[model samples]
Target: MNLTITLVFLVLTSTVRSLNILGIFPYHGTSHFLVFRVYLRELANRGHNVTVISHFPEKNPPANYQDISLAGTIEVLKDDMPVEKSYTSIINTALFLTFTGKENCEVMVKNKQVQDLVHSKAKFDVVVVEQFNSDCAFGIAYKLKAPVVGMMSHILMPWHYQRLGIPYNTAYVPFHFLEGGTKPSLYQRVERVLFDVYFRTLYYFVTQRSDQNTLARYFDEIPPLDQLAGEMKFLLVYHNFILTGSRLFPANVIEVGGYHVSKAKPLNGTLKKFVDEAKHGVIYISFGSVISPSSLSHERVKAILEVVSELPQRFIWKWNNKTLLKAQDKLYTDSWLPQVDILGHPNTLAFFSHAGMGGTTEAIHFGVPIVAMPVLGDQPANGAAIEESGLGVQVQIRDLNKENLLAAFRKVLDVKFRERVKQVSKAWHDRPMPPLDTAIYWTEFAARHTNFTFRTAAADVPLYQHFYLDVICVFSIFVVILVGAIRLSLRVCRSKSPGKASEKKQSKKSKRA
Candidate 1:
């Protein structure tokens, strides 16, 4: 009996700490870095070792983890991904090619950096990758000898998993089409259609080499590309209860909620001073790190400053560099704002932002209403979430003029706006688990179920599945194509029918001969 108890205790201890993870995030964004911080820290808190590879060195490495800070300096996390090789152009080309499905992720698998990292993996026992970069995940994870887990932040790519025909609870996975405003325009709709076709062909192209390499890495023969879905170990998506209802999910896909988190800290005095004096309450404007204030147009900058200047609410702009010094009179302009801290202040009523995932998550964390003026990509989706959930309002870039800015500010303060945000805030806070703890729990969950496959409808699907389900009208197209081909062939055959015309043609041929 004592032996049995001792054996069970050892198994539990081994299961939890058995994970030796190497996290790969070549992304040069703070938002991506912070979202995973709580979870990794939680894992570190559990006495598990963790490692990070980012654009910058992690100033505070996890407590128990080792950081193989390969990207030069800890500050490189704040730096840009090296794109000087006309890399951006290659990426754009890849994106364009991938829009239809030309996948080059395998090249990443075989890349020098990828190979070096895989070769360097001596003590590491598990691999964790951010799904934000499909290339990085496919490359490194394909080569790693350890169990690999992928973390998907946005609904955009997680749905790609769904598209592959993996069974997943759709209610939980973030859907861009949750609301009408987010629905694609005619051009966007057309682009998406062609993009899928292109991407399918592109995936075949990009992964052709790496897929072979991945197979060889495991000492296995290469299988059909379509079978790639079944091979992945596990996938975790950042989602909460409101986001996920009772939905079917693949054996591998898990919802590890609260990926969006702020490094815990109290507000400093300078940040606090600005927040308290904003009599009309404060409008926190931030665009994260990559969008330098120096890059925007003077006219647009002037308009933004002027409009926020007009607002009765005290404006606290988080600018990388000052565009308009005029706000020095009533507003507080700071080159660096402790964004999460400022959002938590009592005087803050609304956030004027580009709706970055980090900023949005902070807003959600504090339950602050948002005036989301999305710039591009997932920012729009994040902004739409605020509106969709009735937590805040979304303003477009075209409408950032003074009048529109005032209107948006006023709308956020309206009784309805506050009420709605309060409701969402309550919902977010009322969760059975806080995001940090939830993240911690799921981190261990991944450690527990390391053998599951993280597939959604996407990995299990084919072109035929899409046609039968998403494109029901294509059946008519098949009929039309068949009928047209048959009709045209019959017409051609009839044209040379064995009647007088054929006999005349034969006689003419004989005369010529």
Candidate 2:
């Protein structure tokens, strides 16, 4: 009887399955790292052993989580592209990613810890990798023989979707960096097409080759980058149709935009007191983890300060500098604050933001209106989307001045703007489950069912065929043949008509004679 009970216990213990997940995100950007960290934490909380290879690791991670830091990689990347200079332009951003991605990949593959993980007998159920800049991480998936899932912390780019055979029509889905509202003009559409073609060609000829060479250095045999990308079981995009226009995505692609946001934590005593004491409400200002506020030109900073001083509302500015610019009665300056909690506060009136998707989504979640001052990458696009949604006003960085800032504040502070954002927030919260729960379900589903069946044939199809150039060629040939036939028949009729006319004239002459 004791032996039978022991056997039953063993069977029950064996039936409780747990998974091993490996996340590879070697990017030095804090925003990118934070997005991956949220998902990794959730997996750990759900009883999975999660190991992340990243440049920035959490200070105190949960029990089942481990972080393998590639912090040295950031030093090498900083030398290649200085952090002080803003990479605002699309070309500059792309070039920066191209150079830094190659360097980071080399650093990651050669790192002692990562090397051990690769060469050892350790196995992972699923491998999650950042798909934006570096493709070299795919080597880890290949080495571990695990199903791969690519995670994007921003909206899907045209090139990214194309790899999975998803349609990325330039007409509707503008290029990621194009900074304009929805319903683009003809000129904007043309520019979007040209930019898409240029980037795609550049990636195929240059960036993709660099990635392949890097992967080849570590692996004996590997598939082409496109094939490896298409092999991903799922892609978790940090975007939603509410912000990005609704479009059809492959079954493997999942939207987990606000996975990082959660119930507002209690603020520290100092911040809670400051916010609670504000009489006219408070404004929260932040440019995100990257893009230091001190880097702004003196003129721009002065203009912002002037506007803050003039405002009747109290302000909390997240300026990551040792010294404050200027002390004012109404302004509170700090290196960092709980942005989501501040936005969630009833006393908080509006957000002054750089319009990053993370901050934009949080504001939407908390129903806070915004005055967006976009800096780089997708910030401008996010700002435009916010404005189009009637929740914010966008101020061009170059056009920053006291007048512009004040006008933007007034526009966003309107009660109508607040109402609009509240409606959006309600819609966001109306989902069947929380974003984190949905993300976990899809992630585990991918691990259980390594799906390659959902991949579209579009990736394998040639560009010419994919765009139906052959159909256009065939139709052109038919039109040409029809036009030629019509011309020949007209010529034949002309010739016969002249002959008949001459014969009739001769007959008339003979009869008269």
Candidate 3:
């Protein structure tokens, strides 16, 4: 009777604590949404009522899960970004994001389904939004009168550090876009500082301004987007200190790095057979969803094929188009792959990747050494980190040739390199609580403490005050005044000394006469 009563009580308690969560992921990029949807689905599986608004909706969802699809409203990003890094490329990327953010915000707000929700008297415990290149979702969350939770698919954006009080000291901490690792030379550190300033300035003036204007068109009297971002109850960033070096973060900035990486599912029959039949293990090559493999130049493609043909190991390439390689026995091509399962397989030896955050984290988790050929965005930083961490080597795309590709493969396949990666993977998995559980716990915690404030005082402080520029200015002025006073006194003492010497000489001559 006591056991029966206890079970009933537990069930009642769970029912009482169930929450209604509204998740907004406006971006159309599959890679960005891929990291976000896992947690949103898990919320439903855990018995929370979840309504998701996004471009990609699940085909079938749990009974408690609902989707407001934004499909066909925006174009997907595929092979649209250039692989090269230059001044023009940087400006173009920034402008693309800025304009895209505004358009997405307007579309999301004007959506009929979203407008219905806005008009309805429904209540949500929390509103979760992706903290990517847009802040327009925050305004929607504000209208719902629910506490906000910000989710980062990757590391915090350069502008986020100041508001969230995450230490971004450029001396040792590298920018996401730069190829520099944690420990950089004098020149690289200077480059980091300059780029940091450039990114923040561009974001504030161009990106934020564009997003804010879009929000104003739809919502009246909405709090500033930056203010809304700062007021988030929790900011779950996809980062782990083991892979990313230790850094200071405020209490609200939770590190739920590998939450998207679920346990490896069984590979399909053909893939399993191919992987298992490898004589010398497998090399899995994928450039992620953003960069299509077909976009590669013929020369680069030929170089990759030449190197792969020379290798004894089997290769599985994620190619969206047909390939010219004739090694049917040694190569497998797939448009869509079970990446996590493939990486988890014992027969998988190494990963040749574009070093995107999603793929790089998975490589580290599986202890698979990487042959990183970074092409764009944060890939450079990730590639540099992979090399610095002894997990793999980075080959720049411009320098990618048969010889370089072969050498990179050789380096990662070394026993020492493989062993180091395994050790790091072990450390990565040694967390006290599972990343997903930590995320869920914090999500629920935010719902329970909706009235509580988690933002640091630094968020409330202005840039000049936060960096103590005013204090430095005062100290500098005092130092200059003190130096001037000392110089004036020294000049006066020198003049008096000359006069005294002359007077003494005159007195001596007069006394002698």
Query: TM-scores across all candidates?
Result: 0.72, 0.87, 0.89
Better of 1 and 3 by TM-score: 3
Ranking, lDDT, top scorer first? 3, 2, 1
In model 2, state the lDDT of residue 235. Answer: 86
What pairs collide in candidate 3? none
Please give the distance, in angstroms, between residue 327's alpha carbon in candidate 3 and its true position after superposition. Answer: 5.6
Q: Candidate 2 regions off by >4 Å?
A: 1-16, 76-88, 326-328, 483-513
Among these predicted structures, which one has the highest TM-score? 3
The order by descending TM-score is: 3, 2, 1
Candidate 2 global CA lDDT score: 0.78
| Backbone clashes in model 2, listed as residue pairs | none
For residues 333-357, write the lDDT of model 2, one tens digit per residue: 7887888899989999999998888
Q: What is the lDDT of residue 4 in candidate 3?
A: 67
What is candidate 3's lDDT per residue for 56-138, written digit by digit as tens?
88999999999999999988776566666665766566666667877788788889899889778469999999987788898
For model 1, the superposed segments whose C-alpha errors exceed 4 Å read: 1-18, 60-63, 73-125, 136-139, 162-188, 195-230, 241-251, 263-266, 323-327, 450-458, 465-513
Clashes of 2: 0
Evaluate residue 69 in candidate 1 and report its C-alpha lDDT on the 0 to 100 scale: 46
lDDT, candidate 1, equals 0.59
- The window of 10 residues in a row where model 3 has the poorest summed lDDT is 4-13
